[model samples]
Target: MDIDAWWGIIGQARAAVGDRADDRDSPDDPLPGALVDVLAVLEPADIIDFYVKHIEVTDAAERYPLMWASFLIEGSVSGDGFMDFRDGLALLGRETFSRAVADPDSLADLPVVVRMSRDEGGWIGFEALSLPITDAYRRVRGETDTLRAAVEAAIDGMTRPERPGGGTWDPEDDDAMRLHLPRLAALFLD
Candidate 1:
């Protein structure tokens, strides 16, 4: 699906959930429920397209600089940690996602980041954002993975790198981290 079409789904979910979309404190995520409600009305083809588009949109945010951003925020990038970080970024909505993808360092100035820095207990990974498609499929088709599996098999056919590559500085180098991510350094490192 096209980027606009994909974002349309996310927009609807965000709108439907209202404040729940950003409620990290809540143990229950109403976003996926809201997203499923939005998805249940769409044609079946569009649902498959939505899954592919979701992956593409999240992958597009997997830049090397953003990994360092993840490290700064989360203390380290564990297996699939960066993946989950990108999920959170996508959930932040189109403007924030676009800004962050274009300028990874700009994230330090965001209100959400500011809150995270202040609340050391806070983290920015929304793994649940990945749930709605499968949930919606099951909700619509009823207790069957066959359709979802076929769609995912087609998506998985195309290949990409395991992890994003290319960075001139090491995460261990405080000076370079500060120099490259000055604002984030002030927020998380300093």
Candidate 2:
């Protein structure tokens, strides 16, 4: 699937589940469930395309400023938590995700982040809206036939840089965080 096709599934899921980016109470809740319903009807190949495009989209989003913004909003977090952070952004759908990719600090304007700043946001990460697609395909294609090789090959063929192409910086540098994400830092750190 292309970007629009990839986002189509994500958009449908979000609309089904209702802005679930911060709903820590139920991590997957109805979103992943909705995805399961959507992906179930797709031809197996389409599922593969959806997942590959998901990686591509999320990879493009992994820039320094975005990462910094994640740290600011979530704080002292990493591993699966960080993955969920990006998923949280992705879960918001294309317009919000694109805005965030273009301007990480722009997140402060979002009500979800605003709630999060005050410890009211539910949680982060929607697993990049991937699980249901994979599960759907695997069920059709069979277990141990995750199509992992095909997905990895497509990703490998892409010109992925070691880091997302924005310039790098220490995420711990308070000055850098404040400088690059003044609005976000203000909300999260204050």
Candidate 3:
């Protein structure tokens, strides 16, 4: 699968979904807007292939730390939690959902991911969240090969040095994570 083509498809989907977001007074479930957009443009098989290739290239635990952090925050807010949010994506089938996340840009369309990325201290939790998300994705895909395990182990090995101290954010120290809660909640509440 050509990743560039997949990227283009994802871009088109985001624009299409953004257009829909503009038309509505408020969308009930904006999280999957990008996924819906992608499905409209690409075949499910192609999407899966794109996703597997994407994951093969990107180091979810290292390269895109902020995106991973944003995903966890989004999950927490949505009541899906990290694993459930991943499972929900997996519902798109192993490949579509996995590939969707492999592209960091696709995550921007997710309300919580966007909000968290903009948060002042969101990086505080990036180290804490990245590995688990990557692990979950691999687990969901049933990736148990030696190479997969080795890669995950390498990522895990880096965790300690990468985040020396406790990497969690103190709510009082930085409430940026929750600053947009009201706006996000209002989107669903109405």
Candidate 4:
């Protein structure tokens, strides 16, 4: 979506939600209103695209997930080891991850850095008992999956609903019925 339009929608939703303009330091900070508004307008696929494009994901599959997971779970880390990495990200549990993924209403509660690390093949990897992705790592990874699922769910929710009597709304359905009716009447008929 266009940034200006996204900002306008974000501003309106933020206003509706009683969000204070002065509270945030930057757009990245938890502008709860903007987060909800933007997610509401943008598709899940788009969110994933944004994440994948903006993050400089490395081809080093072995190190990348650990790095991403460490930053997300522990905030920061100095040295490198699978054990140290696992220990750092041990706090994030599965349900916490699930809410991050499933609930658009709970977007503000999400961690500051929410990105994903994937292998070249695109298969999501998180085994609970393996040599790596140990209990802690797996939990955080599951949480990442939760975020992905939530974004997808939001995208799915944005589609126009089925009509009352029988049929579903199609791509050609006019915004006059789907959105702009009241605004049109207020400008012209009022």
Judged by TM-score, which candidate is best?
1
Give lDDT tens digits, candidate 1, residues 1-190: 7899788888888998886675444577777688888887886667877877777788777678888888887778865888888887887789878988877788886666787888744456777455778778777778547656766786778565677755647877888889888899889878
**Whole-model alpha-carbon lDDT for candidate 2:** 0.74
53-118, model 3: which lDDT tens digit per residue? 434433332222233333444533222243344433332233444445544234435543444545
Best by lDDT: 1
Give the candidate order by descending TM-score: 1, 2, 3, 4
For candidate 1, the TM-score is 0.89
Per-residue lDDT over 1-190 for candidate 2, one digit per residue giving the tens place of the 0 to 100 score: 6788888887787777775533544734776767767776888778888778777777778787787787787775565555667776777779988999899889988877788789875555555455666777766777525567778888878876466557667878778778888899889765
Error of 3 at 159 (Å): 17
Each prediction's Cα lDDT score?
A: 0.76, 0.74, 0.38, 0.31
Q: Which is superior by TM-score, 1 or 4?
A: 1
TM-scores, one per candidate: 0.89, 0.86, 0.32, 0.22
Which 10 consecutive residues of model 1 have the lowest summed lDDT?
120-129
Residue range with the least summed lDDT across 10 consecutive positions in model 3: 121-130
> Comparing 1 and 3 by lDDT, which wins?
1
Task: Report the candidate with higher lDDT, 2 versus 3.
Answer: 2
